[model samples]
Target: AVTRELALFKVACTVEQRAEILQIAEVFRSKTIDITEETITVEATGTSEKMDALEKMLANFDLREMVRTGKVVMARGTQIT
Candidate 1:
């Protein structure tokens, strides 16, 4: 599975504009999900074209933000013989 995630955009966006920006984000929800735990996650799935668009949108929304730690992951599956 492929996922796209946006982080720290809450801190990136000025507090005054966060609400309006979030409303705008609703239109771009696409196949992604945005989470709001201690660490945030903004992930989605779709074609490269769609993913690119969503990524650009997030970048624009969080221009000053950059991935701090990058990505960390683990595989999940059952072996079949």
Candidate 2:
């Protein structure tokens, strides 16, 4: 089976910290969906573990909010198991 999850992280950031935050998001293969003077929102999709790791990294900054979806699973073969 294959499993995946989606997460959105909102982190408070300063102008100087914006580049660093973007770098972390890049490393996680996440997309920066929204950005404001005070916050940056990142959208990530991967395994649960990956989401956890990304969250941990983002926590270094001022993590404002987080939203995560339940795991989505699908069978690999044509038949459902």
Candidate 2 similarity to native, TM-score: 0.96
Question: What Cα-based lDDT does every candidate model obtain?
Answer: 0.45, 0.97
Best-fitting candidate, scored by TM-score: 2
Deviation (Å) of 40 in candidate 1: 6.2
Candidate 2 clashes between residue pairs 3 or more apart in a chain or in different chains? none
lDDT of 2 by residue, 1-81 (tens): 999999999999999999999999999999999999999999999999999999999999999999999799998989695
Count backbone overlaps in model 1.
1
Give the TM-scores of the predictions, in the order they appear. Answer: 0.42, 0.96
- CA deviation > 4 Å runs, candidate 1: 1-11, 30-40, 63-81
- Provide the lowest-lDDT 10-residue window in model 1: 31-40
